[model samples]
Target: MSTRSTDPPPIRSRIDRALIRGAAGATAVLLLTSCATLSSGNGERDNVPEDVSTDITDEPVELTLAYTDDPPSTELVEGFTEQHPNVSIELQQTPFTDYVKTVTLSMSSDEAPDIAQYNPGAMRSLIPSGHVMDLEPYVEAYGWEESFPEATLEPLRADEDATRFGTGSLYAVPGALSVLGVFYNRELLARAGVEEPPATFEEFEDALAAVDEEGIAPFSVGGLEVGGFQVWNTLLNAFGDHEAYRDWVHGAPGSTIETDEAMTATGILTRWVEAGYIPESANATSDDDAKAAFGNGESAFLMIGNWAAFEMEEALGEDVGFFLLPGEDPDQVPMTSGSSVSYTVSSGTEHPDVAAAFLDYLSSPEAARIQLDTGFMPVDTDASTGEGGVLEEINSVYGTAAEQDGIVPFPDFATPGMIDQLTPGVQGLIAGSTDEETFLSDLQAEWDRVHG
Candidate 1:
């Protein structure tokens, strides 16, 4: 990827310092020092865009990596290994149900892999903490601009501090372009006399009601941990206060995650669950299990990311069809959170240039297509197409979103620890342990706890 303009002031100084450090080192400690100098750059290259560590020599050059169960992770990693034989990857995968916990905890330790899947919100945390090596200069010097997308690349930059390497520099890479869709079994929908996907929330409720008549779970949700919360958050991002979503994320002005809009949207889910549109046992379903239920046809509609495509295709064998989740904001871009599961040279990598080169290779669309078909739209806009044909299909269905300017970041992207609080609070709301007003109160209360 490449850029035309200079980085923001805060970011520019960080870049100068990194450049001053001179040639990258073969020893990990020296390389890390250079990387720490520039945390933020390419702030405007918004949406711009893997792993393998083959060696276990006492040299300790491994790039440890982690991911939740997404199909492409395995596929892409395998493919990446084929091209670069020396880079060995240590895989740590969690079920989609347990992914958040696995990812959240691993990120806090120095033992965190040299490269692990990380979200945009965490970039600020990791870079400021010096847990991740800044990729801004490598991105610029290597002209990552030629391959990476500006819109996709921008979110991962944290440019707030010059010495801290907090903002405006590249710390993570977007793993995939994740879009929200209502995955349905066409056979089941046809049986319900709903031949087509509904284009509005009112119609969606009607369909769920029809499905509930047969005693099937109408929608799937992982009630445990954050799985239960994503269902509500996806809706909130798709239809609620988006600016507020960002404000809450950036600690900006007038954050309204507690706004009536957010509450109303969440209330709708609680209403659905109470009305039997969702199963009472849903709170116990793991995220992967919940998504699996949809594949099993135990649920009629699964509000899921494109990553679920391969699972559906594998389980049902041509039984699945998908459409965007219709929401109150018809004018809004369909909800999606584009991610770059980034690769970074570890503060401890022994071969920084080789590690950086390997990371650069992993960022390519070629490497992305190999991952277990993450179903993310390639952040490399000009790059050739990939075999993960699922991404191509998602792009076709949701391409209309591009016209909306930018897809909103997932509610999970709004802030770290936000969803850890949100999921349980929302689950309690749906389960009747908390009312909507109280749900809102608990949510903000949790934010205060985490932010404190």
Candidate 2:
């Protein structure tokens, strides 16, 4: 989702530049900002119930939860395990780089966890194979649909034309909540003499230019393989003149990435690399490295999700800020975001009722507060529009853009292995191994392979 940036120059100087941009050749920096577990006013709240716990049965009804390493948010989880002591859980952490494959192999096994942490494409394979359960009945009985915002369920709900859309039935429960947006440092802007973050694209570029004159990197990206893909993927949705964003994602044949809008975004992104507005070496940088660089003040901006809030605060301190990624056309979608996180009942579960109960419990307004306090957009209805919870500053941008009908889901969330198909080509694009025409053609080729 797009973050709302203060007008003129939403980003300022609190950049932590010491974080190294590492993917291929770059090294990571160790610039640490002031440490205090920063919060924007009412940061984290004691929202977890006095007896916060998971429902685990002691009769060996065990499930394993798989997650990639982002350990800070689990701050309170370890302290709240008393309620459901009967159930035991195994925590499996994978590197973000290896998560996709690890999830795939585990799912195909009979020994798969009854409950596991699943991401976008992981459920696609299982849902289609009838390996997962349909949660609709449970959803109805529990009123999950009533309290649940339909948008939050978009990732789980397959379109009626499932063959055409590849949205298949809901499979895994959504675990994490995240928001994707362009991040900037306030102190960096002040050093560049920029007054505020730009509301429009032209001004945004101007800020990049101001940062450029000082010989500092203006943007950070993990362009090699998946790293380089994030920025391009983001821009594709923001400026997608054609509805190619979803079509390209669903891969329902003839879905080429070479739409006019796709080409424009690619060209501009490539130019950003050439102009040094972004690090030319981003082609080899990992996502972590780029994030660290931005946090350490080596770069001026980062296009990232809300989960990275803690990391940024750790690297850049209280002076850090965010804003919406400006779209080429304001009337177009403000910017695109992924469903990122959601919860669904496992089709294989014998205790569907119990699982569904857990989801409902997790969706409560109180639950939403727990999530907001974790620094993410909540699926709960109240948090999205209720009192000033979460970052009102950031939510203002997201809410305004969404209200204007300016939101789109991430391409990967719409289909299976979009990242698998799109990333190599984007990495190729960055290296100039493929021209704009061929990049689109390749994208279409992948789409055809999947649909036909």
Candidate 3:
């Protein structure tokens, strides 16, 4: 049950900034260049199938699926194929790093898979070239709005120009979900005299200080990678306005990350670094190393996504627990950075309905079990994740955020080059080389480069 051995897939780990940086920039250029002709091309293909059916035909149908994530993607396909004995799904999996670079091209080719994994960056061009089908038709045909959480569907949507997101045509459906939150070592918390998970932001800080006083490292941060900015991401979700952040990430006109709440969140992270809650050595630590350190009882808390649950649960057993980074107002609606392992049908597919059926199966009760067992939150948030465990805890917290439509895109999704700024900027914060103002300003500058 150890999800980690020596190497892990990027989907199960932090986003690899280097892998996607150049590829994303190239994809953005495609989006920009295509904007002039995308409208005409968008109308050329009838994205909607004339006959939409949720039911698959009994006639033997062969479909190919391209994906990168294994546990859920492979197992989910098997689950779907099992239910429809007459249908065969061939899975094409590429490594996460290579997938980002190659998927866009593959998706636009003449022989694209019937179904392909959804990548926001890939969609920038795939969507405009009329290679990717807009899933709005499937969404209505299958009643996905009732099955999958709206929050999970938001990022999969984008304008025809592929500039703004969280609105316009639906492009994909989530098979499994992940959310950002705090993972704590129970014994360490108790040793620090904290009896329960903090219910408010104020209580959380006090607990961190208490753990510090108890001579326990307050946080095991992957400051060397996505772990660094994720601390600020969760804090911003706690303190900042969700809509504002969403708008900024989706590239709303004149949207800016240089807000008062953003400043406060950045400042709070700076204060935590100064307080020695986050170690300076974190700048050199990989996410895997940091998680291992936490598993070894080196830190009281680690803020990360639920993708770490299976590994953490196997390592710590009942000694670990999870909770969202609590908000300043106890009554505030829960909001968090959440993303999904989603799949989309190719626009050129002859069996669009059959391909759509595979997506529909993702929200079924059966797939929910596979999704949870694979260390991902099920798209069907209402589906039971069984009795108590860190997995259940994650499902519980994620369901609350989903119900209120509070799960938003990770900050890295703001732009192609944003993670480049985030990881290094946060390293500066942790290293005391970057001020909060500079960090926020740098982020805004990157945002302007793409979104301006």
TM-score against truth, every candidate: 0.71, 0.74, 0.90
* lDDT (Cα, tens digit) per residue for candidate 3, span 1-452: 00011112443422223432323222111111110111234457545454465655667889999987777787777766766767799989887667766788888777889898887777777778778887776688789888888898888889988888889999999888888899999999999899999999999999999999999999999887778888988899998878899999888989999999999999999999888998889999989899999988999999988888878888899999999998888888888888888898888887777788789888877778778777888888987766689988999989998888878888877776677888899899999999988999999999898889
Q: Between the candidate structures 1 and 2, which one is better when assessed by TM-score? A: 2
Q: Considering every candidate listed, which one attains the maximal lDDT?
A: 3
Question: Which run of 10 residues does model 3 get worst, by summed lDDT?
Answer: 27-36
Give all candidates' CA lDDT scores: 0.56, 0.54, 0.80
List RMSD in Å for every model shown.
10.8, 13.2, 8.9
Query: Candidate 2: how large is its RMSD?
Result: 13.2
User: Which digits, one per residue and each the tens of the lDDT, describe model 1 over residues 56-175?
Assistant: 223234466676534445555555444444556778876544544555456656466656665444454445555566666567656775555555555566654322121367766654
lDDT of 2 at 265: 81
> Under the 3 Å rule for N, CA and C atoms, how many clashes does model 1 have?
58
In model 3, how large is the Cα lDDT of residue 377?
88
Q: Give the TM-score of candidate 1.
A: 0.71
TM-score order, best first, reads 3, 2, 1
In angstroms, give how far residue 166 of model 1 lies from its true place. Answer: 10
Q: Rank by lDDT, descending?
A: 3, 1, 2
Task: Estimate the overall C-alpha local distance difference test score of candidate 3.
Answer: 0.80
